[model samples]
Target chain A: MDVFAFFNLNELAFGLSKLPMFPYFDMAHYIISVMSLREQPGALCVSQRSPLACWFSSMLYCFGGAVLSALMLADAPVAPLSNTTNLLLATLMWYLVFYCPLDVVYSLASLLPLRLVLTAMKEVTRTWKVLSGVSQAGSKYSDALFVMVAVGWAKGAGGGLISNFEQLVRGVWKPETNELLKMSYPTKVTLLGAVVFSLQQCRYLPIQTHHLTFIYTLFTVTNKTRMMLLGSSSHPLSSLESFLYK
Target chain B: MDVFAFFNLNELAFGLSKLPMFPYFDMAHYIISVMSLREQPGALCVSQRSPLACWFSSMLYCFGGAVLSALMLADAPVAPLSNTTNLLLATLMWYLVFYCPLDVVYSLASLLPLRLVLTAMKEVTRTWKVLSGVSQAGSKYSDALFVMVAVGWAKGAGGGLISNFEQLVRGVWKPETNELLKMSYPTKVTLLGAVVFSLQQCRYLPIQTHHLTFIYTLFTVTNKTRMMLLGSSSHPLSSLESFLYK
Candidate 1:
């Protein structure tokens, strides 16, 4: 009950106190969404203005927004957090130690729209400023009950160092073998080269609907055809801007 | 804007209505959660207390609870599903068709505890019945925004039948090759056999911590292990349980 009470009371205290605390939670949000989209291109990648665009957009915007608020309350740092102001200045040590290994990124995304709907009853009566105020406030605090998961190979921090040490002690490998298992110099160079190549391809892809259609159709019919796109943000518009205007 | 209004106004109506329509939404809530957990077991599964017990209990209680709800909402062919329920239901369907292929399970688990905190503030004054009623209502609705992803090869719903037809029409496959990709007789039987093997292993594993330690530690270490399990929902207790009783 004390554990429950401390969490509940501090939440009330958090709502009453106003400070910009949104970025911490947002940083921890929706890893699975980003990862899956990156990993599963053959299955999930969708072109814009297709029948799937609105769906993807809502998911990216709303469900994406959903994860930003997952830890707003429960993860209020034990002390000094009840009155936190600077969102970005703190060290991320909490994630290193107390992180629950659960994948809780979707919890917030799933609930956010329902919260909006429930709040809509007041929309007829409340001013736009008031609603916007609530949303702005919501953005500052991510949900707290769930854990950010131990970091992964992608982010480079999931206690793999400790595990590797323990495994080494347990006689999984000899010291010389372990050195061989690590990424070699050529592998690192190849990885860097691949990233550069993909980024270069992003610039040449036809972006506009008609331009892309004509170009792609021509390419498909040609005796020798080639196409390339890499490092494009899921949204083609953003990808186009990355190479062009930006 | 029309999209936004249709969703908002209907939610307004849903809140006003007091009908018992809990079964549908719960069905859609946990697919994202379950999928992520299953996919990232190395990162997420906690091996503590009665390891198999927690795993099996969570599977039997939640997954078993889940499939029951899936049929409930998907089969809501009953009439008078409210301007509200229809809005919620149709939007969910839209998500299914246009769903981002990203696994969204982590999003909900992260957010649930935070919502609990916010609710706790009101709980200070509210009657227990009111809190339970709200919780009961919430369980029925599940998380509303995230899509229950369309069933695919992972969940076994993407039939190779239509895919083959589309490929044939596109001249991408010979009909014979397409037929070959579909499951053959022995493959289907072997798949069934694999599932049976897994469930059997699940049953035989030390779901009860006491039985497991007594049986295994006795076999391996032959002496003792001192483990402290503060809380374990599986087997209703831990190794200390056997010492307490039989």
Candidate 2:
């Protein structure tokens, strides 16, 4: 089937599996109550309010990443089968069903009413600050086991990205064809124009969300009307975005 | 017409459009080099043998990231085609070009040859420590910027993977013929096994380099002889261990 069906199935399974840990939901509820007393953005303020929330957020954040990495490692097919729509849906569902309770608890706790919650949150932030300091230290001077791992990975990602980008360019042009320079002139000009305009402006030129929505809705209605007109199963032309994804 | 063709066309168009001032290529080279050096198990000790090399490497390391980010902001087709392969190529190319130049510069500038280079390298490494300290100062914590960005993206990736994995499992069933529970039995059991295994053993599984290579290679190659072989392409898939600019 399509992506959404796959997501729905998996989400149902994941939800069912977590049914036994229902009590932890209460812990999240309590945490939310505590957070509700604190100030907005007071994740690390300190006293009791700051530490609990800060620790909770930090643990959740890291745990969330670890879980994601683990899942990928666990044999998930990641081909862009349908424009990442299925993948996005599946992840969103998991977040709502599995991670939401913890997040809600944290969010609620952060919104706690304690006068000193901000103070505690500040300290909590400080504790996170210290850990980062350790990583920075490791990154710079070397020797911190954790830093080494983090930096090594970061470096690798950096190197890999650069290398790949260059190869892509080289691969596009046949050595004999000067096709590198010859491929459709209009396409080249459009690409160049876009690049120059972007560089000069240093601004994003994304189509507005509303514009996209309008277009998609318009396209859908047009397609349905066309089907009615033709009384046929065939589509007139493939959608631009859908074609690109495939 | 194919994925590689599309990717290469995008890269060449992007690269050519920003000609004369190919700042990105320069930046990627330096950034990846530095990050790689920083992450090396014993980067500092190695610097003793070649201070100029260390200096050059660090420069390349920082440069790669800045360039990649810069490239992203450009309105080129590069953004869409930036899969793992392109990322690796960009960074690797940067290293190949800049590595020797940087080494020569460092060696020539040093007064006492080896000993002086070592001393200079130590002094440079100390700069990072100073930078970390500055970030960790009483109330103004700056290190969180990188960690938050890194961790935030990881969370997003993880969330995506979890959702997608669920869908993959759900896809295994013939929806018309099978009920949810019937289909879920094996899937649920497998997930449960994973959960228990993860919780007790502290092992979270996600595919690593081996699998990435397997899938990417699978996509590119089309023969039985290819099936029996495992060779490194001039470019390869990006990993958590790879650099952003690469």
Report the C-alpha lDDT of model 2 over A83-195, residue by residue, as the tens digit: 23322333333233223655663354334343134323222222222223334434455554443333322221221212222122212112343323443321222223223
DockQ of each: 0.01, 0.02
Give the Å shift of residue A71 in candidate 2. Answer: 5.0
Off by over 4 Å in 2: A1-72, A75-246, B1-28, B31-44, B49-103, B107-246
List model 1 lDDT by residue over A198-232, tens digit each.
22223332232223222222322221111112222
DockQ of 1: 0.01
Scanning candidate 1 chain B in windows of ten residues, the lowest lDDT window is: B145-154
Q: What is the C-alpha lDDT of each candidate?
A: 0.27, 0.31
TM-score of each: 0.17, 0.21
- Candidate 2 C-alpha error for residue B41, in Å: 15
Error of 2 at B149 (Å): 8.3
